[model samples]
Target chain A: MLLLVLELAGTAVFAASGALAAVRARLDVFGVVVLGMTTALGGGVIRDVLLDVSPPTTLRDWRYLLVPAITSLAVFWYHPQVARLRRAVLLADAAGLGLFTTAGTTTALALGAPVYTACLIGMTTGIGGGALRDVLLREIPMVLRKEIYALAALAGAAVVALGDRLQLPAGPVSVVGSALVITIRVLALWRRWHAPVARGLDG
Target chain B: MLLLVLELAGTAVFAASGALAAVRARLDVFGVVVLGMTTALGGGVIRDVLLDVSPPTTLRDWRYLLVPAITSLAVFWYHPQVARLRRAVLLADAAGLGLFTTAGTTTALALGAPVYTACLIGMTTGIGGGALRDVLLREIPMVLRKEIYALAALAGAAVVALGDRLQLPAGPVSVVGSALVITIRVLALWRRWHAPVARGLDG
Candidate 1:
């Protein structure tokens, strides 16, 4: 099905970002692989665990594991050239984020989640893996620190919600909604954009 | 009441180990506290989440949060002395591992977990935080790859199983089991003891 292909593509792109992050950390082959694998599968694992779905998805489907492994190998072997393509990599990651957020939240909603909970799960699905990867890397998580990161997920999720409300076919809704997220995210990163903040914490 | 005290002591020691580990990682004050909190509470978080207990212990009880914070501040101030007391820190950590393993498995067994699963959880409870810490540090997990780590938990859990078979009081049995684990771990570390297959892998 198209959904399966979308899932694998999203996972592979996410894994590349994870591997790229690891290279910046000067991690070896093993650490890079671990980072990539965890980033690729972490959101779904958290989703499954929170949902109390025993024997989480990563365990049930071998593709979930294989996608990350293959991606990691590709990144490791071609890192120098790949690093040069940061813009391409970031764009791919944005696409992955949009797709994953749509798929994960929509699935949760269909599985009987309340709308609010579904929204949270959608955001989590979009950002949870990267957050875990950053935390393990001992860096402040992008999900928390980057204002636009989770906000993009929220925007896509709202579009998905409106589409569902209007009884639109999922295919069209998914593409449009995911595009919104990708555009917002890429623009934010490229522009070094940040949300408005009232600074001045007491020292 | 006595069991409560023992649990607090174990948590404190676990928090201390986390602080020590984070210090080595060169984290700042807030990072040290966060790492310590994770070290102390991470195992229980995993257990509760897996068991579908809402909100987990750290949220339910303020002590879990504050204890690690206080421990972190102490470490921040007296880091030099703490460095000189590495042997003592190791001993305390060993003691914590033994106690947590017995206590964690006992709780699981009480909640009607299968004996083998309880034992597995017990081992995880003992070392899960450390594994997470290392993962965040992007290091090979000390608990997984090296040391007399999970083995100590297995030994204590086996003791608890035997004690249950003999209809021993759970409290005394837990203490004895924990003592056994601590003894084994201390002796192993002190004697430069090791697991089999310490040979170098193919490079």
Candidate 2:
């Protein structure tokens, strides 16, 4: 039940980001909706696909689809107000990133995936939506270009994998893992931290 | 047997395209290999995921992985020669598109998917790799911006779907469908056919 709620919330936040991007790009209403849905669902879908989950849980449940659709439409109608709340959105996005990464890692571990694969899936789950949205909008993915995003997710996933190997309880381990991700992301954002670019490329 | 051969050939062609794109983008060696693998396997992975095929055939088979890895390395070493064969590469890409689209539609149909779903999967299978490649290269997907690429794939997929509905033999149906896609793509390239853009967007 908690996981479901977190997933829905994450979907809404990601959808909002996608909708905002679409509006900025001057996409039509249909394009806005499509991009929103893709952004919200892309990560989970990628995770599920890697884990061999058919049809994906998001596709199986109408609520998952509805959350993004409604959220996108809401953003479309009231974007100015929504954009004004950018700080809140960023914070919520960090929370979403944490929740998705931990959840993806946990799910992969449950499914008997190797530790390394699970960690990769977890990072992918956290960053895949934003990557897809950027791709659709013809921009370099923020995670790829500059950000502590993917590394944070990977770190959190590693914590989960470590906990699993140590035979720790899942519930507390998940909480700690998620907190780690959220902290790292929020701090990175606050400090404006960036991943280094390829050296000597400009020369 | 034939399908396997087609799939391998398609993977190689897509890998070449991706490696060439990565070289043009000035990605490092690691990025070149990763992009090549992603392009070669992406479409098939998407199709398999949608159809509930666990582990995706590309991931399960060593040959599928090996082909792209080798192809990318070859392209990385001899990019100038590869670039010089642009015409040949384009033609091969068209053939790959045809084979993948028809094969994807057939696979979905075999899994008892609805006709519309099968057609979409088929089109995705044909175009998903190139879209991923473009996304990674920070360019708008060629299919979305201009060209008859996706439509040609969709039309071919529809042919296969129609053949299935009519209870035609899979062999001849696939051949005809693939031929339709190849013909349309080749003609589109020769005649410079393009999909219409959104009207009044420039203004």
Candidate 3:
């Protein structure tokens, strides 16, 4: 139940980011909805496809589709307010990163993916939507350049995988693991942490 | 057997395009290979996923993975020659578009997806990889703006779907449909046939 709530919350936040991106790009209303839905659901769909699950849970479930669509609509109509919530959006995005990474790791492990595959899937799930969003808007994916984002997700996924291997209770493990990711991401933002760049190149 | 051969041919051409794009971007060796592989296999994987086939055929089969990897290696080494083959690349890409669109539509029909869904899937298979490649390079997808590119693929897919509805043989239908798409695409390029632009806006 807690996992389910976390998943929905993550989707909503990701949808907001996607909608904002679409608005910035001056996309039509239809484009905004398309981008938002893709951002919220594309990662999970990619994971399910990799795992060989049919029909993608997001496509099959009405609630999953509805959440992102409604959220995008809200953004379309309330741009000024949504735009003003920059700090809140960042915090929400960090929370989403934590939730999605752990959830993806646990789901992939349950589906028999190897630990490494699970970790990759987790990171993909956390960052894939935003990547898709940026790509649709013709921009470089922020995850590839942003400070410590994908790395934070990977760490969270690793925690979940380790906890599962040790037969830890899933609930506590997920909470602690997600919290660790959130803490890392928030601190990275505050500290202006950045991944190393290739020297003597225009990054 | 024929389908498999056609699929691999199309994948090779797409991989070449992707590798060329990576070289133009001045990406490192690993990045070039990654882009090439994504362009070659990404479309089919996406179609399979949407059709609910798990593990994507490209991921499951070693040959599918190898074809792109090899093609990318060749491109990385012979980029100057490859770049000079722009005309040849255009011809090959048209062939790929036709083959993939028909193949994708047929596969989706065999999977019991609705005709409309199958048509969309076919177009996706034909264009999805290139769109992904462009997005990764931080550019607007050519399919959305290029001269009747996606429309040509859609027309071919529709032909295949119609033939299937009339109980035609899959082999002949595939050949005829793919040929039609290639002819249309090539003609569009030669004659400068383009979709109408929305006037009075920054297109």
Candidate 4:
């Protein structure tokens, strides 16, 4: 039940982020929905594919599709209001990232992926959608740039894998792993922490 | 045997294209190789996942991984010469497109996807990598813009699906469908055919 709620909430938050990006790009209505849907579901789809799970869970489920569509429409209609709530959106996005990281790790582990593979897959699931969204918008993915985003996902995924290895309860493991990610991300953002840039590259 | 050959050849060609894009983007060696591998294998991975085939064929096969890596290295060293051979690269890419399109459509059909779904997935397989490469480089994907690129893949996929519906021999059907795509794409390029742009948008 908690997992279902987290899944839906993450989808909604990511969809909003994508829709906002589309608005900033000044794309047409079709593009807005495309970006939103992709951002919300792209990671899960990729994870499912890597795990060799057919048809992808997102493709099979109607609710997963509908939420993103509605979120896109909402963003298209009232982007100004959405834009004004940037801080709240960022918090929601952080929560979504944490939830998704744990989800990805657990799913991979359930499918018998090794600990290392599970951690990587988990990070991919958390970051894939946003990376795709940025790419579509003709921007270098923010995750690949200054912020400590992908690392946070990676760290959370590692925690999940570790918990599983230690034979911890699934529910507690998930909550703790996700909380670790959320705390790190929120602190990074508050402290204006940044990832190290490549040595020769101009900022 | 033919499928394996086609897959490797297509991966090499797509990897070259990705390496070229990385050169244009002035990315470092790591980025160049990463983009090349992604461009070479991204489509097939997506297709396999949608068909519920786990562990993506590319991930399972070392040769599939190796070909892209080698191709990327070759491009990194001989990019200037490769850039000079633009026409040759285009021809190779066209062939890769046809092969990937047929491969995607047929696989989906074999897995029992409906005709429309097969066609769409085939087109996705044909174009997904290039789209991903462009996205990573922060450029609008050529497939989504001008030229009859994706349409050609769709046409080929449609042909294959129709052929299957008619109970045609798989070998001949695949050959004919792929030939159709190559012919159409080559003709479109020669004639400078362009997909219509949005009426009021700035070109």
Identify the leading candidate in terms of DockQ: 4
> What range of 10 consecutive residues in model 2 chain B has the weakest lDDT sum?
B25-34
Task: Give candidate 4's fnat, 2 decimals.
Answer: 0.26
lDDT of 4 by residue, A106-131 (tens): 99999999999999999989888888
**Candidate 4: clashing pairs of residues:** A52-B54, A54-B52
- lDDT of all the models against the reference? 0.78, 0.84, 0.84, 0.83
Candidate 2 vs candidate 4, TM-score winner: 4
Find the 10 residues in a row with the least total lDDT in model 4 chain A. A25-34
lDDT of 1 by residue, B27-55 (tens): 99888888888888888777666445678
Per-candidate total of colliding backbone pairs: 1, 0, 2, 2
Model 2 chain A worst lDDT window (10 residues): A194-203
TM-score of candidate 4 versus the correct structure, residues matched by position? 0.62
User: How well is each residue in B1-203 modelled by candidate 4, as lDDT tens digits?
Assistant: 77778768989999999998898889988888999999999999878768867778888999999999999999999999999998888877888788889999999889877676677678778888888888777687766453578768878998999999999977778888888988998898889865432232242
Candidate 4 interface RMSD to the true structure:
5.4
TM-score to native of every candidate shown: 0.62, 0.62, 0.63, 0.62
**Mind sharing the TM-score for model 3?**
0.63
Which CAPRI category fits model 2?
incorrect
Listed per prediction, chain B TM-scores read 0.93, 0.94, 0.96, 0.94
Residue runs of model 3 more than 4 Å from their true location after superposition: A1-45, A48-106, A112-123, A126-130, A136-138, A142-203, B195-203
Q: Give DockQ for candidates 1 onward, in order.
A: 0.09, 0.15, 0.16, 0.17
What tens-digit string does per-residue lDDT give for candidate 3 at A1-203? Answer: 88888889989999999998899889989999999999999888877767876777878988889999999999999978999998788888888888888988888889877676677678777877888888777776666456477668878999999999999997888888889999998898888865433222342
Tens-digit lDDT string for candidate 2 (A1-203): 66678768889999999998898899988888999999999999888878878779888899999999999999899989988998878887787788889888899889877676677678778888988998878786656444567667878999999999999987778778888988998898899875433233354
C-alpha lDDT of residue B68 in model 4: 96
Q: How far in Å is the alpha carbon of A76 misplaced in model 4?
A: 2.1
